[model samples]
Target chain A: MSKKSVPVVNIADRLAGFSELWSQKTVAVLNDYEVKLAKLRGEFVWHSHEDTDELFLVLSGRLTIQLRDGDVVLAPGELFVVPRGVEHCPLADEETAILLFEPAGTMNTGDAGGPLTKAAELVS
Target chain B: MSKKSVPVVNIADRLAGFSELWSQKTVAVLNDYEVKLAKLRGEFVWHSHEDTDELFLVLSGRLTIQLRDGDVVLAPGELFVVPRGVEHCPLADEETAILLFEPAGTMNTGDAGGPLTKAAELVS
Candidate 1:
């Protein structure tokens, strides 16, 4: 593909353009992985990816990844990686923007099935 | 490992604490990939990853990825990925902080092998 075929994405601009809580939009693809952005608020269900690790980077506001053992709190510009098979729940006290890096086909909700589970949609 | 075992990384904080141009420091590991931070200024040797695609997210300042066909310019909060085997060189007129995601063993210099070639080191 030509260079023009690849789109340039501004994380903040894209996040500001969308306002859906817990919905992830794939902004770019790098080989087998996808770069995603989402708005998060409240609490998500407990879940774990048995085979793939999940990466979370806070773009704005704050986020807390609650685990059975403890919580990993992330402020703006902070990031954390939840190892594979480790169950956890993510929460944000306020509306927060986040970036995620993970293998393609990796479910956002992982093994848990719930109302919040949705496949990621590609964003231009 | 416990939640405490995994270090929480603030991208801006880590980038601020270090001051080495073109050197990448691995901050976190997620599955088969490594999350890295780096400071870029001036120009880097043209190279390509034969096996793994490279992801670059600009945290501050601006960056230009010079490709054989065209250039991809990224501003703060923007990102671009150079597909595997695509020769490219990255440049930044001013000091720039960036986040990188790629397979653990991928080299920064790729097949071009030059003075800038170096292995990524793990950071706390």
Candidate 2:
């Protein structure tokens, strides 16, 4: 029933460990999904996940998910899901802490990949 | 690109809408997984989801996930995943608010269906 010590993912504690903007750190794994935390600043590359929907929950500051049709604004304790195949660009006026729930191998920049496109690094 | 108006799910606002203990309400859905919020008080029936893992993130108060070998206690801003097929019982000494993430249609009392067994109600 047990493997290692009690596995508790402290969101705040994990966020405090890193400061790199736009970089996501995997905090926990639930089945095939990965729970990730990232600090966002300014605007990100416009991208669209072709395989799965991406969930973004703002932990601190504010986030605006810019879509082709509209912009979805989220504050602390708020979340939004960018539907799969729908192009979206995430931006934040201030440094924003966010929780991302997606498949394990999801890339940061979907479809369009360039400098901001990178893999999520495991934190703990 | 657009479905309706803004689809932002505010966790605190949704939590305030319900007060039924051990009952979960779906606030948002991403892909096939449903994000649910539940208020817990006292002990829940020991159960296990044989097919998928269940993730529990404590939003308020404390929660002790009693496992077969050990107990995983979580506070506000903390999360833990009970692996698939692992029997566990969740209990809270005080009123607890928790966010649950699992596949849609997953039962409340998993393998064991009793009085606590029910379906998650969708909220807004």
Candidate 3:
């Protein structure tokens, strides 16, 4: 495979370009790479992907990944990876911003039904 | 493969646990997953891995990934990936902290022989 270059993106630069909450906007793509931004509030739907793990990195505010066993709270500069086939939901008290990295074709809301299942195109 | 649980580690907790600089310490492992910490200063040796690409996420201060063409500067809460077979090095003005995610056998200084090519065992 030929070497494909992935552009260097700054979170502050991307955050400055958009402001709406809970809307994940793509910043760059590297082969199967998918990076997105979303401002989350209240609770998200519990969902799980049958394939591929999901990486969640908290950009600002607090984020909690609720699982069947327990919940992990992520503060600013913290990260958590929700493994494949694990049922999880994310919640935030106020407006919380986050960056998500996953393989292409991974859903934001997993298999659960939710109003926030965004089918956003990858933005270059 | 049975589901192997990997402990969720907080960066602040890990940073507080260790004070020595430039030493990359392992916190958790998920199958082949390896997470490390390093306090960088000055310029690093330019090298490249023949295998997996490397992920760099800046924790504090500034980090510059020197490429053959140009360098990418990463501030706090920013991330960049150095593709496999691409020569690169990390430089810091003062003492800067960073978190790295790569496969188990990925080298910190790549193939370049350096004093910081630590063979330290992964801490549990």
lDDT of 2 by residue, A1-124 (tens): 3433777999999999999999989998988999999999999999999999999999999998999887888999999998899999998999999999999999999999999898999988
Model 1 CA RMSD to the hidden true structure, in angstroms = 2.5
| DockQ by candidate, in order | 0.57, 0.55, 0.22
The 10 consecutive residues of candidate 1 chain B with the worst lDDT sum are B1-10
Sorted on DockQ, highest at the top, how do the candidates line up?
A: 1, 2, 3
Which structure among the candidates has the greatest TM-score? 2
Task: Identify the leading candidate in terms of DockQ.
Answer: 1
Question: Candidate 2: global Cα-lDDT?
Answer: 0.93
lDDT of 1 by residue, A14-120 (tens): 88788888988999998889999999999999999999889998888899899888889889888988889999999999988899999988888999978888999
Cα shift from native, residue A29, model 3 (Å): 5.0
lDDT of each: 0.88, 0.93, 0.75
Which is the better candidate, 1 or 3, if ranked by TM-score? Answer: 1
Considering TM-score, which of the candidate structures 1 and 2 is the better prediction for this target?
2
Model 1 C-alpha lDDT versus the unseen true structure? 0.88
- Minimal lDDT window, size 10, model 2 chain B: B1-10
Which parts of model 2 are misplaced by more than 4 Å?
A1-4, B1-4
Rate residue A95 of model 3 by lDDT: 78
- Model 1 error, position B83 (Å): 1.1
Give per-residue CA lDDT, model 3, range B13-76, as digits (tens). Answer: 7777777666788865533556677778888889888776777878889988888877888888
Cα displacement (angstroms), candidate 1, residue B26, comes to 0.4
lDDT of 2 by residue, B1-124 (tens): 3433777999999999988999989988889999999999999999999999999999999999999988898999999999999999999999999999999999999999999888999989
